[model samples]
Target: MIIANISIPLLGMVDTAVMGHLDSAQYLGAVAVGSIIFSFLFWGFGFLRMATTGLVAQAFGRNDTTLSHTILLQSLVLAIIIASAILILKQPLSQLAFLLIDSSEIVSQQARIYFDIRIWSTPAILINYVFLGWLIGKQASKAALVLVLVVTISNMIMDLVFVNVFGMTIDGVALASLIAEYLGLITGLYLLKRHGVTIKLFKRLSSKQVSLFNWHWLQLHANIFIRTLCLMFSFAFFTTQGAKQGDIILAANAVLLNFITLMAFVLDGFANATEVLSGKAVGAKNRSQLKQSLLLTGLWSFVVASLFSLSYLFFGQQLISLMTSITDVQTTANNYLPWLMLMPVVAVWTYLFDGLFIGTTRSIEMRNTMLLSTLCCFLPAWYFLQPLGNHGLWLALLLFLAARGVSQCFYLPRILRMY
Candidate 1:
């Protein structure tokens, strides 16, 4: 599961590498802005996958085969519905996102091209999200790994053929991604048939056996919705602020953001593991196992995060240079690299607890705490940094992560005590 999750981001890294070779710095910056916008716009609905996996895993644990199938079906239905909505709103969303990002006109136009082509992949992308979560819930981690690996390899190959061989540029990258996602969705469905289906599971697929409006399921999903929304907005706001500073600043921030994303992808392995184990425990009403999972995952998170921090502390500048060659962007990114180094150390607990909370379907508290913290901690820090220029922006983000970690700490004990 972790390998699967990490592949998604590494594919983005590969895309970055391809774009880095383009003749102009503007292309690199355009992909950065375009990706950040879509990341928030699309993956923000990630709650569907997280919620489904937790619910399905718990249902599986309790031997409630019918409920597990219902969860999977509902997740696909929701993904399709949401993807359609994004399609209708794509133009306005693009306009709004670009307006707020405040990049150079050329970069903005390039981003729009990427956004337009990429928007069509929404349905396939969201369906894959459901498929992935279901696979994880079923403990078919190897299948998930294969699905992502195939998609990543296919995407990289397409990127090379379209961008390098054919000179299709950013649009080529977007098209490559779209093609890869549909291929992945098809692959996922085949895997589901080969590895997931059974006589017992088929019996639960009948319409009469499933409820469309499960209150508990809806409530769990809604909480995650709120949580995901707040999280997306925070990053969106961060990008918008960077954009407002001009392209050099935006490009610098983009380089730094990729590093942050790389760290998140690596740590996500531990968190994704917790999601499976913790959700299964909660589903079985095995409270002790849930507690144990959290403790073990927390220990793992700290160790992994410490290693990441050390890597960044020592080689941050060198890594930033590897991502881009523009002198101004490189210098600006190096200035902000320290924040990325601090991020893993401060936010690892928050990431682990997030998986635990999602698994236990304890999302309302998660949402509420995040909402409050974003307004109280993230906003104030950003507002205070207004006078400090770019340094201030980095400081605000640092505080934002720190605040989330601190808030999670205070709230976690209460939930643990309740368990």
Candidate 2:
């Protein structure tokens, strides 16, 4: 799981590195802006994955193959509906996204090119999410790893070919992603078949069962959607604020954010394990199993996060230089390396707790805690620390992460009691 999750961010690092080495920072800034827009758009529907994982994990724990299969179909149906809507509304959505973001003219133009091409992959990306969640829920870690590797590795290779070899710019990166997602979707379906998910499972479900849009599912997804939206908003706000500081800061911040993304995805590998194990424990009503799973995953998460911080402390500048050859962007990124070094430990708890909550299907609490963190913690911190420039932005983000973990701690007792 750790190896699989790390590959996810390596794709982004490749994209950044490809653009960062170009003659101008605009290319890097364009990719960053376009990526943020999609993060807001696609990740807003991240409930497709999280909700499916929690629900399917519980079903697997109960040894209910039928219910787990039903959950996957339901998630796929939802993904199709959402993806179709995005395609239909792509034009207005693009306009609205650019309006909300305050990027420079050159960056915005290039970002639009990236967005137009990449938006076509919506269906593949969303369906891939459902497949991933289902695999994780079923404890098919190797299958899940294979699915992710197929997408990310393919994307990375094409990124090099299209950009470096063909000399295509932002469009090449976008095209690579578009092609890779469909490949992933195909691979996901093949894995599902190998894992005993067959067309017969679909045949068995009645019309009412096929339309699994029940009140409970809707309510669960609504809470997770809100939670994910708030999370995306924070990152989007961070990116927009950096853009306001000019292209150098925007490009430099983009480079640094790859570090944060890499750390988050690595920690999330443990969290993914926690989600499956914790969900199974809940379904089985085994308190000891739940506690043991959390303890082990929590310990490993901290250890890994600490390693990230140490690596950054000792080799941060070299990493910055490696990502971008531009001396100005490298120097600017180096100036903020300390904040990157501090992020892993401070943010690790949020990833751990997020896993616990998702595994248990505690969406309402997740929703409320995220609201508190974003509204009460992050926004307020950024407001007051405006004098600190980019340091203030990084601090606000850190406070947001800390607030989420701390706030989530208060809910553990209630969650355990309910179980």
Candidate 3:
């Protein structure tokens, strides 16, 4: 499960690797902007995965096969509905996001090309989320790993073929990702069949059961929706602000942020494991197991975060050089390189604690913490510090992470003791 979850972010790294080699900074910036837009849009709804996994895991733990099946069914139905809605709103949303970023006309135009093409993958991406969530609930980590690897490898290969071989630019990258997602969906259905689970588990659902399912599912997802929206807004704000400054700054920040996101994806392996193990423990009502899972996961997150920070500190410039030889982009990125080094150290606890809370299904606290972090901490800090320019933006983001971690930490004792 951890491996599968971590691969989600690493896939982004693969895309970065491809675009980083593009000769123009505009191409690199376009991919970065386009990716972030979708990251927030698609991943914003990732509660489908987190919530579905926890609920389904709990059902599986209790040996309620029917409930598990119903959860899966309803989740799929909801994902399809959401995906369609996103399609309906696609044009406006794309325009809004492009406008927010304030990039050069060339960069924005390229990003829009990618966004328009990739928006069609919403259904595939959402369905895959539900399928993966179901696999995690069934404790089929190996299968989940296989699913992610297939998607990542397929996407990477297509990215190269489309971009380098066929001379497709942003649209090619977008098409590769969209096609890979659909391929993953098809493969997921095939694998689900091989598992040979009883369809009875998915049936015998009553209207009342359906109603309860919808209510609880919406409750859980609503909280996550708000949380993810705020988180995405921060990234959007950062990129948008940087774009307004100039294309070079936007391009530089984009490159640096990709490295930061890559490290995050790697560290998320531990967080993902924590989520799976902790949810299982909660389902079994095994208090000791839950504590052990959380402790070990936090320790693991620290180790990975430390290693990434050290790597960036020692080899940061060389790594940037490899990503792009653009002297101006590299020089500007170096100025902000320190933030990447500090990101994991400052943010590791927040990510780990998130896994813990999600596992235990204490989502209201999770939602509230994010609300407070964004509204009380981040926005206020950004408003006050905008005078300092980009430093203010980075500082606000760092504070948002710190505030989230602190809020979760303060609530942990009460949350754990209640159980």
Top candidate, metric lDDT? 2
Error of 2 at 327 (Å): 0.7
Greater lDDT among 2 and 3 belongs to 2
TM-score of each: 0.95, 0.99, 0.95
The pairs that clash in candidate 2 are none
How far off is residue 89 in model 2, in Å? 0.4
Give a tens-digit lDDT track for model 1, residues 130-159: 888888888888988988888899999999
Q: What's the lDDT for candidate 2? A: 0.94
Q: What do the candidate models score in CA lDDT, each in turn?
A: 0.82, 0.94, 0.82
How many clashes in each candidate?
1, 0, 0
Per-residue lDDT tens digits for candidate 3, residues 249-330, read: 8888888887777777666667667777877787788888888888888888898889889999999999888777788888
Instruction: Indicate the TM-score of model 3.
Output: 0.95
Model 1 RMSD in angstroms:
1.9
Show model 3 residue runs off by greater than 4 Å.
197-212
lDDT tens digits, residue span 1-419, model 2: 99999999999999999999999999999999999999998999989988999999999989998889889988988999999999999999999999999999999999999999999999999999999999999999999999999999999999999999999999999999999999999999999999988888777875445667899899999999999999999999999999999999999999999999999999999999889999999999998899899999999999999999999999999999889999999999998999999999999999999999999999999999999999999999999999999999999998999999899999988887777
Question: Measured by C-alpha RMSD in angstroms, how accurate is candidate 3?
Answer: 1.9
